[model samples]
Target: MNAENPQSPPVASVPLYQLKAEFFKTLGHPVRIRVLELLSTRDHAVAEMLPEVGVEPANLSQQLAVLRRAKLVHARREGSTVVYTLASAEVADLLRVARSIIGSLITDQAGLLADLRAADRG
Candidate 1:
């Protein structure tokens, strides 16, 4: 683990948690999340996804580039249009799981708020 022995593989390789953190960081943008959600249903051209994502062409292009770099989506040229699709089905499943977990959190928070209100009324 020193500079001179840099080529040597450590007793343990890089931690999986660090890789997971990097993966989540790639998905940390609202625009990217929306783009992924749209692609989850079906492939879409840049033109087709523009209005749905409600961003300027420049912004959309930027987000697409990020997803492309992360290998989360694949882009192809169909005629003059640039179409994008999820790189794998697993991306869709991950989005779905995130939605489910967030939904549960929202429900739990609502219950907590209702309990607080009832206690205040007593």
Candidate 2:
């Protein structure tokens, strides 16, 4: 926005990579990741998630707020309970892709370990 022009459209101050880095940083927490993974399966109420997430109520609420700010999840009121769901199906896909990548890496590591064991035996 120009100082002289009061009605000018907003310009992006942050670079794309910086924005992406911030987004990944939002996912950097273990509790946040667990909450996202749970939301990936289905919409969960705060009460329901309390047990599953294995965190104190205040901690879970804080984690949920971080996810909400990141726009990775949506929250709605169902009576007195707050229900949360993934903001996009792509989030679940991202989780699945991450699992596949980690699985492959672990498989490769296991193969290397087996080879080492065989060499040691010989």
Candidate 3:
């Protein structure tokens, strides 16, 4: 292998492990996930989002800040309010896939719990 081949792909200076860790860190919170889900549907004012997501204003604001910093959500000013939306339509697809996975996992867990309860009673 030639050391200076122009055709070679450039190596990433940041390690893949570090990048993965950061990605997971950004996604580890439930509130952030909900914010992503809401934005996936349409742009919404921060005040409007609070009631739908059932989170306190301070907490929702914090989660939105996290998503904004991660570049997952974009914001625009509308009069005195900030309207937030997904950075791309692809984000909505990502949220859909994530919800599917979570739904399957929850269903499986519920079945397992039922079996355990039956066994305990028997």
For model 3, residues 1-122, the per-residue Cα lDDT tens digits are 33588777776579889998997789889888878888877889999899888978999888888888988888999999999998889878977898899999999999999999999999
- Model 3 lowest lDDT segment of ten: 1-10
Q: Residue 74's C-alpha lDDT in candidate 1?
A: 97
Model 2 has an lDDT value of 0.93
lDDT tens digits, residues 1-122, model 1? 64558887655567999989999999999999999999999999999899999999999999999999999999999998899999999999999999999999999999999999999999
How far is 60's C-alpha from truth in model 1 (Å)? 0.7
Model 1, residue 78: C-alpha shift (Å) = 0.6
Cα miss at 6, model 2 (Å)?
6.5
RMSD of 1: 4.3
Best by lDDT: 1
Candidate 2 segments exceeding 4 Å error:
2-9
- Preferred candidate (TM-score higher): 2 or 3: 2
Best prediction by TM-score: 2
lDDT of 2 at 45: 96
Better of 2 and 3 by lDDT: 2
